[model samples]
Target chain A: MKLFKKMRGGLSCDDVMEVLQSYLDGETDTETARKVASHLDECTDCDLESSVYQNIRVSLSTNKAPIDPVVLDSLRQFGERVSRGEID
Target chain B: MTERPTEVDSPAASADATEAFNRYVIPELEVMYRTARSLTRNQTDAEDLVQDTLLRAFRAIERFDGRYPRAWLLTIMRNANINRARKKRPDLLDDPDLTFERSVDFAETTGPEELVVDPTFDASVTDAFAELSTDFRQVVELVDLNGLAYQEAADILGVPVGTVMSRLHRARKRIRDHLAEHGLDSAAALPRGATR
Candidate 1:
């Protein structure tokens, strides 16, 4: 299956893997992201990896504590004081 | 480089700096705190870091361009953390704690044979994250969680862009391997639109 998939595209799984991080991070040029996305469509392993990567990113960003209100207020006040030349 | 304002001490100049801080920098304190927490992993230390970061930033507000405040602040915070770390344990600079990665027996947990038998394992993503090496976790938190651009993350972490990409790739791979171990590798788990 992997062999057949590779035959259809210029990017084999290895090729896609090499630039997959840049593609995922949206740092890749349009041409490269397109190629990797095209390859991932037919490559189950790469597809799985792509999704797992997205899920992990979502999981990391979704679950987090809100910044403490006290902390925010204090930082704001401190900034004000610095502006006023009250604190160095 | 953006040219720094000539005088930050004049009342008008100070007021402008204050206004910029309120409009541009204050809004990003939450993210700054989040990154600080990730770096310190201790509540008190995170708070101190945030305070120190704000202090340093306000002092240098005349030089700030008000573009990409989070990245700018993170760069400062990263430096402050390094300085703090150096002060506490100067020798740690010579010897990093790389043992955390080696201490984990990946073979037993993520071995291919074990993955096959696990059937349907379930583990929290957070738990898997905790098991990652500090270096990997730092990249994950900065780039993945905080949504910093790769260059921004690299700038904040003081590594090359290529290093950021490679570390992010390996970090995500580790998390995926952990998920696979727990039997979360179902096709349904893949996000919609993963394919063209």
Candidate 2:
């Protein structure tokens, strides 16, 4: 339960929307995130919108093109060589 | 600003630097490669970029304090990417103070049925990510995808934390709207409010 709501009134939908990313990203202060969470509990629109944003983020993160094995090996070898000053 | 060449003052110090590079920097190649791939969006270019970054990091290895090597490597990669981009097209450079006022605007062009029933959400998301401007994509990759904090991403990109916040917000909105346009059928497979 957000007991802080009694100390600070709940944020309006527009206000919650304004910082929704920060709220989701855990960038918001504790009081502000709790306020946003409280708003989402009562507002289906913001809840669904937040869900969609998260999905997009997951997609971007997981959809990376696989690195070429040869390129990977080459980079590793290069790092080793460079680390040892085997090559300038 | 003029650049000073990094010099290894002694053989013992050089060996220490090499040891540090193996211990601190080698372990972070995968992350560096991923970030490079995201920035360059090309396999060849990404490889070259990582190579260039590693070279620079190696030269400066003696000065590294073994702190947050991944972030330090990423900052180098970001600078290398920008310098490469600047050389190709000077206008692609970012102006940190420019207000991204339209960060919240979106075109909700997709229907709920498409999001809930379709299976091509990943493809659509990939396309949308490609469609993003380089600036927006940088924050998304560093903050959202790479799981770096706002302050860390800002430091890596040489931008203010506020800029990272605003740009990331805008970039995520565009992505959300793009997913919405495709009807987010993928969400049906996920529990409500599930995040990576």
Candidate 3:
């Protein structure tokens, strides 16, 4: 399905799909990221796929559980004691 | 067997070690705690794990070379967690993969009736997240929720970086599918003025 359709940088929609997640996560290498970006720019189908994934990321991120402040404070004090050589 | 020479740190050396611990390890406590929480899935265990990690890091501070402290601390935390698990469940010694299966029980209280209404994109995503398997949800929690990079998540989860990528992408794909089912796949669902 659209495997042979080449977009910018000669990346097919399938090729972009393979690494699109990595590209969105900023985990892809420079060259592959560039190619995937170009392909997304030219291919509406791939672009929509990217948008959907991005929107999902945004939604998931919004629901991040808040770290407990009391827990964080205790950890900080623990670190301080460790730094002061109070704890072995 | 030859006995090794006893070593003792001079005052200056001890001070330097303390300085290094403060400089490198102090700032990463929160991240360490958060990762520990993800790994232990319980508040008390997470606190214990982080304290254990801190003690180990303090002991090793003199030789740390002060580079990539977060990565270094995470590696220590991973080892510490393995030891904790081994001590708790001796059976885990036979299968190493079982050591990293800690699950994060996020949003377990949201009832099914709440999910039935309000098919907004956010609601769909929350539903999908709840439905994800422990492995998929763990990866998402490490990378997306906890904001750890792929390599960092892999280090904490005791998996390869590629494994993290695979789990994270599949998890998000599942969420995207859920959104599509709610008619959120169209361009209208994209953020306003989102060119990418």
Best-matching candidate per TM-score: 3
Pairs that collide in candidate 1 are B121-B182
Instruction: For candidate 3, list the clashing residue pairs, or say none.
Output: none
Q: Write the per-residue lDDT of candidate 3 for residues B41-67, one digit (tens) a residue.
A: 888998999999998998899889878
- For candidate 3, give the lDDT of residue B66: 79
lDDT per prediction? Answer: 0.68, 0.70, 0.78
Question: What lDDT does candidate 1 reach at residue B112?
Answer: 30
Instruction: Write candidate 3's Cα lDDT for A46-67 as tens digits.
Output: 8888877776666666666667
Candidate 1 lDDT, tens digit per residue, B17-98? 8787777777887778777766676667878888788778878888998788877888888788777777777776854332
- Tens-digit lDDT string for candidate 2 (A1-88): 5443322237766787788888778888989887888877777666777777766666655654455678788899988878766545
**Candidate 1's residue-wise lDDT over A31-66, tens digit each?**
888888778778778777777666556555554444
For candidate 1, give the lDDT of residue A30.
88
CA deviation > 4 Å runs, candidate 3: B1-13, B100-104, B109-119, B192-196
